[model samples]
Target: MSTATITPKGPGTLRGARLPKWSPYAIAAGSIALAVGIGLAGGLHSRVQWGLIAAILYVVGTYAIATAVEGKRQAKDRIATSLVWVAFLLAVIPLASLVWSTVARGLKVLDVYFLTHSMGVVADTEPGGGIYHAILGTLEQVGLATVIAAPIGVLTAIYLVEYGRGRLSQAITFFVDVMTGIPSIVAGLFILSLMLMFDMQPFGFAGSLALAILMMPVVVRSTEEMLKLVPNELREASLALGVPKWRTILKVVLPTSIGGITTGIMLSIARITGETAPVLLLVWGNAFINANPFEGAQASLPLYIYQQYANSAGSGAAYDRAWAASLTLIAFVMLLNLVARGIARWKAPKTGR
Candidate 1:
């Protein structure tokens, strides 16, 4: 009988490669050490500053350490991971600063009375006013804008994705691309000019019209992307069932794209919510809270911020109110984002159990 030769495979031959036991621990230790080192060295009083320094140091140290341990090929991936974290940290900084600044200043004026009261009785020279009017204007204008833009945007997207392949479609697409970058002031001016031609006086409706224009291209682009993501097989299957094309689109296509469409619409709303020029040039503003968008001047959050800062006396109370209003605006945007996320999650396609 011949003795069979046994051979052992190298560690690299494992189908699922395992990380070295010390690698992660080494990386963590290096990150923590560098973070603490830099943070302490910076001598900053603010916790935000300390956290930022720590984050930056952690990433740099981790990358350097990863490069030493991993071969150059793997080291590139490690460097990329570190860079992504750095980018994430950079984005977080301004968001954190905004929140902190708003909270610190807003706390001085965020009483229950502040939320319910308007600026009607408050003197411009004095302080202790509220943003009830501004809040109402923001809600009505943004709500009306959504109502106006949603149908047009969804239809345009449908046309582009389904029937658009030629010159007309290309023209529409090109215009939409151009409109995406049109200055906010240009939208305001366009609405102003259109209203002037109709001999209509400036009103909240004009502001709403301008906002809708601002919102439309964003909605169209976003909806187009979502519609394009729908598999052609779904469309073919629907047609195979003897369904009308419009019916198939209304049922199968729209339902499949609804989640993303909703997300896009929400984003579009956010995009135009803070627009000041359109509202200022069109609706103007009023101190009293007005529920109707058609009849009178209205004040929104951005306009309110502008008015308070520009018109208010140097009283601490006025400054406090401005900060509080800013906080409320930020809160509204955050809430919308959360709701959009929830809708997207709930409406996501179901897979196998």
Candidate 2:
């Protein structure tokens, strides 16, 4: 007897059609065109409304087309990917618009004269004043705040990660969490209340104190996370070499995590740099330069912008100054971020090649 040979199909035999890589771009372009047509027909004047309509159409159209061509399972996956891209665009568009607006409006009056001179005698309606006073005050207050906050924050983080135990550690963690959620205004108010009790006047140091309050919790949180990332084996190995616990931590733990710690500190500073309410309540914005942070009222970029805009009374010059100051503040924060990234990269521990 002879038996016929039989063959079975492999799992790889089945495959489905896929949309091209350029399909998303085509869909997005079509969605924008349709959205614009709808906006024009409906007499919708707001670009924001047009964008919202476009985003919605893009998501819906992507899913519909995918389902039609590639069945339900593939369509669901495509929908998810499309949603993520839509969300990214939604976030980026506003930020791009804001940066563009600030740059465009700021260039009108931003020049060397504007940078060197303070408000000194310039009237709100007049065009010649600069942010010198605000810049000086910002540097002093932020410097003092960093001095006060960084060590305390780093120490607290060390204790929590290395030495903390029992109810005390829990309490400390609870308070840290509470402080993290406290509003900038509330921190300012807390310091303001202390100043009121002492009958103290507004000064740059007071604003620094409020900023320190905000900075500490962020520093603590970031440092704690970074320290935790340090391998326990490093600590064990150090201890095996007859090193004291504190020395091991200082030499091994901190160095290993220093890059992350520095980045976090810089980010925390950036967070506080934009605060207006705290500085307004504590620093009591000054029109002229005040070099002394501890003794007298001082200005900050946020306060300067607010005062310029509020006191403008429809003055074009004041509006221009406000926009220029905003641009400068943005540049400062961006620089800090760049520096932080650079430091992190430079100090990052080398691994196997």
Candidate 3:
């Protein structure tokens, strides 16, 4: 008599038949290959369309194969997983492409000299021009806005979290809410209206005013949230030690949340630094460096990029300058983020070693 060996199945604790580990990878590869074939055959141009096609094929192929081998439930789970991955790629690819394109085009004109010089006498179509003036204006305007907004925002947050009560507090909160939702254009228009009434001219400080209006709500919201996260035990301990309420808040509460507060302020600064509308409406884009922001029209990086692109008229030089300006602006924002991260790390509450 001939005996046959038995192959044991998976544990009973593990329910349902499962597809092989390599099955999804195989399906994805096949889907990509098929999508490429279809794209070439159908003469489709957009790579985005190809990616979508590949994503669809991958999902469909996974479901069909999984259902055939395992079951409907497993197939549904796999489809969901595939879809999430596809969604992530869809979001990330565009951003990656933008960075790549900007770097590629910006390198042609970006240099130390390009950064240090100004476009004072150079025409828009000229090959040699720099964003020094724009850079200076951005610094002054954003710095001034921060100076105007940060203190008020921090104080308001403190009041809301600590001393606020009843109708007055509610009204302040309500107004802050309304201000937070107000558009940059609306802030610009408000300042513009004031300027129109007083016959004021476009100046960097005017842009700073509009930017301050936009920055305040963000700073307030962020600071309020940070203050709320500070443990009440700290406050109680400070108060129990015969410390005055104001002293306790100043010494204990502020220090504890300083990291987050600083981070939020930096992020707010970053947000306003990129704003073009308010600057365009108020500062009016100057090509020459105006060291005095209070008197005359000023240039900013966003406005510089916009001006270059709009006047490019398909000229390669202008396009390159625009890309370089964009790269510089991105770098500035990235630097702010790095600084915020550094501050957060340095100021974070020390835990048990």
Query: Ten residues in a row with the worst lDDT in model 2?
Result: 1-10
Residues 222-243 of candidate 1: C-alpha lDDT, one tens digit per residue: 9999999999999999999999
lDDT of each: 0.82, 0.92, 0.92
C-alpha positional error of residue 207 in candidate 3 after TM-score superposition, expressed in Å: 0.4
Off by over 4 Å in 3: 1-23, 41-43, 67-77
- Which lDDT value does model 1 have at 183? 88
Best by TM-score: 2
lDDT of 3 by residue, 1-353 (tens): 11122234468745556666777777888899999999999999998788889999998888887776677888899989988988998899989999999899898999998999889998888899899999999999999999999999999999999999999989989999999999998999999999999998999999999999999999999999999999999999999999999999999999999999999999999999999999999999998999899998999999999999999888888889999999999999999999999999999999968
Which parts of model 1 are misplaced by more than 4 Å? 1-64, 198-200
Clashes of each: 0, 0, 0
Candidate 2 achieves a global lDDT of: 0.92
In terms of lDDT, which candidate is stronger, 1 or 2? 2
- Per-residue accuracy of model 2 over 327-348 as CA lDDT, tens digit each: 9899999999999999999889
Better model by TM-score: candidate 2 vs candidate 3: 2
